[model samples]
Target: MLTLTDSAMSKSVSISNIRLYQFIREKCKIAVVEKNQATDDPSIFTQPKEKWVTMIVNNSFLLNLFIEDIDFKETCREEQEKLEKEKKRLDNNSVKKRPKCQQNYITSKTNHDNCHYHGAFVYDMNNHCKLTREQAQTMTQNVKLIASNSASGRSMELPKLIWDCCLGLYGIDPPCQVGSCGLPNEMKGQAIKPGQDLMTLVQNLFMNNQAAEKRTKDFS
Candidate 1:
């Protein structure tokens, strides 16, 4: 019978070795013929032939299977390493730096002149147009007083007070005026007339409770 040596038997049988042996037995007619010849040669006592030719053929078959297994494992390892490298590269690319303006929006002490301006009390691109802290406080007080008077149904002094807040004494332009310090054209229309009433202005700017609430929150 064909048998492996003690040392060969002691070696572990890998999956590749079994698969290769099955392939050779099923598909390789020439190799099968050669193996049969080698197997029968020993029994026939062929003239001037090597002693263990069948053993050599079996060892060579095992060696080929072992080589195939090693190559397959090495290729798999190389592919895995390439995929890991690609993953790391993509992870590195995914990280992005934030914009300088957005990163320092709240903490930055430096004023940005290019940024849009809203009103006198609020900071604007033109720092010269921005009101001082004292002026802002006084405006807030004036607004509160106006709101109080309106709540009390005191309509007599409202026009004068509103005009003073907009144009006359305070010299503060209405927030709905066009230009850099004013709201966008979509939000505000043509500049306020010399004697436009506060209710009319409020209705024009804030047509909904949501907008009015937002304005109130901003003031608060």
Candidate 2:
């Protein structure tokens, strides 16, 4: 009888390595040709993850079924709760007061000419139509990056949109890269080039071939 040796494992066969598919393949091993039995290679990216629930007896395979984004609505609700809680916490505090005139919604409705000016306040403070600390804090509640529709059950999520920017805001790189945000190495110049946008250049992102050549020349 011809028998395979343990030390010659490389010469022996590995009919199938999939734990899930092992039984079916083993049953077929009785009929499969020797050369065809051990050549199936599994892909790392495409393999199934091992799944099971602990029970008293031997572990058994589960009939896994596919489902859509089950946790999306739950995740949205959680984030919304977090955002509202943060807003509520900041509602009452030593907030800087804003002038009543600046708090008015309409410029056309306000009598800007004679008495009701935009800057007059109860404490004789001037206002600039800016939100108070409390108001600013509360603004975050309504001003969410994720829209309310994002929580709707029927909504489909497109692949997340990612854009390279000098600053992080609204989950997208903000176009406001000048003045005080510590501008990136690229696009920080006084003026943008013709046909070039502000986001085109970035520091350390370009090749340093010339600098390397100079370094090599100096070292030699």
Candidate 3:
């Protein structure tokens, strides 16, 4: 039920870009799956959350995702039931649908090897598949897609933790000389590389002025 946004709604993309998105993601079908169309919430992407959208097609364009803001759960009974139904459907109709002269697609690993697939065919492994290492990787990704993590009930909190450790830990001050409060880190300036001088340093310091000032204050 997620709608494309201004940054991601483009209809045309280079074939390589599309492949990048797909490469990072396992299955595009379920990366943002909805249970039902009518009652489904369209607000998943609008929430203040960091969502990841990986597609093989757009290799470089990692789009943000919209999902339910809360963690959810359901009785496994229905899911199990649907999978069983899918198995039966494939078993009953695959022979008629598959062509005899069709090229073998999923030629990677047997059993779980093979190529990327979707729907009932994914769950029912005996269906059409591609037989290459690439296909194997694709199939692996699809399974991961179906195992979507939308049920988790928290915002994208992990990133906050990372930012806290890397930036907040420095207490909004310089790189060294204890801190505005008192803590110790290596008080020396960063090592310079050969041929790198004031101009290069200036560009780098633009982003870390606070750190430079803090360092100066510390040393003085």
Candidate 4:
């Protein structure tokens, strides 16, 4: 998600950026496919053990994650006990609330004055007091409710190994000092016009190729 401003580096462009363009144009779907794969395991046989472990630890940590920790057993026991207590509490609450919820629903069904709307019993006109089976079905269809924790369906735009691919080596940072991806810290925020059109041009070229193939087939 590199965001460039409205012509920030119009004068000078980074060679690394140009290399990125070349990668997209030449490698076909490598960037896109690798990007998708990297979402779950970015390193994926590429990164060193230390780097991979560091990345994993940074993202998550269990109470007894490290065996080297002094109180590893104690930490594990404590976490287990806490988890049990939380589970018990949830179960007890569910058992206590079930009868109450059922009772309330039964009470509300007979009386149209108040009814549950979005988990709350409301008297507002916007919240219907009571609905026929058909009305309930119709309302449910019209309302566009999103999941509370919806998963992202979109894949990442670029591969995590953009630098590695360009340089034909692993673990090299972007803009390697040896002129790998293009340069080492070449005006960090340069406005790159040629690189900017990389995606658009690649897509256009692909579409044009497909069109030409279809035309050839029709004539044949």
Best of the candidates, TM-score: 1
lDDT of 4: 0.31
**Regions more than 4 Å wrong, model 1:** 1-114, 118-134, 149-151, 155-220
lDDT (tens digit, per residue) of candidate 3 on 1-220: 1224445545533334545445434443332333333436776543222234432323333333211221223335556898898888675444321111121322221222222211011111233221222344465566556556557634331111101112221112222211121111232365657875533343333324454334333433
Evaluation by lDDT, superior candidate among 1 and 3: 1
Name the candidate, 1 or 4, with the larger lDDT value.
1
Worst 10 residues of 1 by lDDT: 98-107
- Where model 4 places Cα greater than 4 Å from the true spot, the runs are 1-71, 75-80, 89-97, 101-220
What TM-scores do the predictions have? 0.16, 0.14, 0.14, 0.13
Looking at model 4, which ten-residue stretch has the lowest summed lDDT? Answer: 115-124
Model 2 segments more than 4 A misplaced:
1-74, 101-220
When superposed on Cα atoms, how far off is each prediction in RMSD?
A: 25.2, 27.8, 34.7, 36.0
Question: How well is each residue in 1-220 modelled by candidate 4, as lDDT tens digits?
Answer: 1223357556332234555544533443222211122447656655222111121232122212232332222334456899998887675445221111122222212343222211111111234232322344344444323222236544332211111112221123322222111111322365657645432333333234444344333433
Candidate 3, position 178, lDDT: 16
3 versus 4: better TM-score goes to: 3
Q: Global lDDT of each model? A: 0.38, 0.30, 0.32, 0.31
Off by over 4 Å in 3: 1-64, 68-74, 96-220
Model 1, 1-220: lDDT tens per residue? Answer: 1234457448443444565556644443222211124554555744332222132344565667544533322234456899998887775555332121112222122233423222222322223233432444476677668777786765333221111112222235433322222233444566667875533343334333344334434543
